[model samples]
Target: MKLLVVFALTLAYASASVLHGFNSLEDDTNVGIIHGHNAAPGQFPYQVQLISPEGLQCGGSLISHRWILTAASCTEHFDNVTVHLGSIRRSAPRVTYIVSKKDIIIHEDFNRYTVSADISLIRIPYVKYSIHIKAVKLPKIKRSYPSYDGCNANITGWGRTSFDSTHEPEILQYAKVGIISIKDCKKKFGKLGKYIWPSLICASIVSAETWEGDTGIPLVELRSSVQIGISSVDSPKPELEYPAIFTRVTSYLKWIKRHTKLPL
Candidate 1:
């Protein structure tokens, strides 16, 4: 299937705000990055834009030549996925691949209600590595949970740039954020804090906020250049000062390796 321009639509939970959504590409209702600057070419070679047949958009990361890592919520209800790669500009990807539903591997224990186990993988044809396209590194395999508190990270996507904006940026946008302790994050979320399990990470934006369409994107730790989280959810009320939530990658390393058969 050919890539089509689509806008943003929110896929929120019962009483909480989520960052994933569906929107028309031609309309300005749900458009660009929230307070983030345009990303430089090849700055995030592993980044990919995922589009559902219904025009729902999310982000993913290339973990191997044939495997993509993303949010389970992004693939849970969408199929015939269209993935754009090797470019910072959404309209000018170096290559685009159409993946079937059978190729998607979502965490079986995923719970949409709590956004738990919210990670998934997509299988695509083997792609050669290039300056514009490369796989991201996963955290080292370990039996214990990894801690990333206070680490600086970079988040990129083509999601809405502002809470009240009606346009999504055609070019990829990114913001720097700092990983915060789950304790602090839970305190900030109040009742929503119950969902902030150990497998989920919380981050506060150092600059721009992450909004709709930014879900499923990668959160790379700046120091190690390793992808540690997947954008999962955020508060709808920009004024609440809630932390952006991510599905912790290290917690699922074995799960990803089992499905992708990669030495992650």
Candidate 2:
């Protein structure tokens, strides 16, 4: 699959380009994984590093014994993928799982232009249970306990340290973000506002950095510990404090259930 994915500032960029402060380059593709403080090992047991022969490409979450959740843009053209789990440090993974291209599933209605339904799932088939790595708790379908509006959440990944930097961090990094309404996000996004769909989730970070390679990372609700969103877009500004977009997890419940037999 030649996934022609690009977004932010100019739609001509590649998968996760540096937003805000830098000029768009030809070779810089991947989502944002910037500005967050380092996370302790096992702090996020559900987190996984999506890797190809080129090294760390994206971040994902362990959703079930045999399933991993991430962005469709990340899995594109990748036939041989290795998932690193049970560790916060990607350089020294405790457990690694392999998956073929046939096992990958991208949302059928996904729009590469608007990045709608940007979610994807990787079928592991046989994941051994362990304390170091586990499935994340999902929010109930009709539950309103965790309000999507202005809720506190987190984003973690091993993306770039800065927009100009080319290296991915060895240790995982995380930052706190607040869920913002689509209306507010639209106002902040300006010309790019029209592309914000109802199916997507919007969030704001005051001073945190989330850049390329951070795509597909989970946005866990602080109070409920349930993953409500997946990292999708970073603001196209240099400040890196603009509202970021996420693929709403609650919107894809049926699609997720259809692929995995988990009681989700």
Candidate 3:
């Protein structure tokens, strides 16, 4: 769980660094979330905050009234975790949700190299206050959709904007890209030959130099506004490529519901 890789130009201060981006994976045919202006600098959706006094646990997602999805390795246990939404940076005074995390579900066969099952979900505190905060909606399980091409999508996070660089973004940033079929991504990424899985739909500029810093942090598609992909992984090489990989949400809809104990 030593997930310390990054991308971008502005290097971290004598230390470390990363934004708009897109990536995907869906059993359904077509879906996408385009990049738009961020909510605001002071907005972390549900008053969520990072658990770190400084740089600690990776952030989590609120899928329901009582759950937050994040990396299992990001926490020591569940209770000590912090949930921040609304504000972009981790230190911004977000409306924090303090509670115990439970019902953890790590991909049964998660492998960093392949990213086959590198996903998980859990419940968090139900918000007690009213504001511009809410959990992102997961896609419905029963609906079938068509796989689309050139579907606009967006992703925002403070992940590394460049290779092995540690300069993470202070304000929440975003970028735009589109979804592509595994067949095409394979043609481009065939050299890596190991990490690509049918479960991932890559989102990246087919040809372009990336801005100084941006990677990971899930390139999400707003399929009718519900989040469907967590940025997974993508790269031709640290110096030569900016291909970002994303986890397919539809592939795991069953797993999500089964683990989170929800009716799909």
TM-score winner: 1
28-141, model 1: which lDDT tens digit per residue?
Answer: 332465556778898899999998887778888999999999888788876578999999999899989999999999899886665578898999999999999999988878
Worst window of 10 by summed lDDT in candidate 2? 18-27
- The Cα local distance difference test for each model comes to 0.77, 0.73, 0.48
lDDT string, candidate 3, 15-85, tens digits: 10112222332112111122223336434353233353345434445566666655333443334545566
Off by over 4 Å in 3: 1-57, 71-80, 97-103, 143-145, 162-166, 206-218, 234-236
Better of 1 and 3 by TM-score: 1
User: What tens-digit string does per-residue lDDT give for candidate 2 at 1-264?
Assistant: 013223433432545332322223322343235456778867898998888756647888999988999887677657768888888787888888788889999899875566678889999867776778889988666644333897888888887856667678778888777788988877876666787787788777554546767778899988888999887764555443457778888888778988887786
Give the Cα-based TM-score of candidate 2 against the true structure. 0.86
Give the root-mean-square deviation of each candidate in angstroms: 6.9, 4.9, 8.3
Count of clashing residue pairs in every prediction? 20, 13, 50
> In model 1, where is the ten-residue run with the lowest total lDDT?
1-10
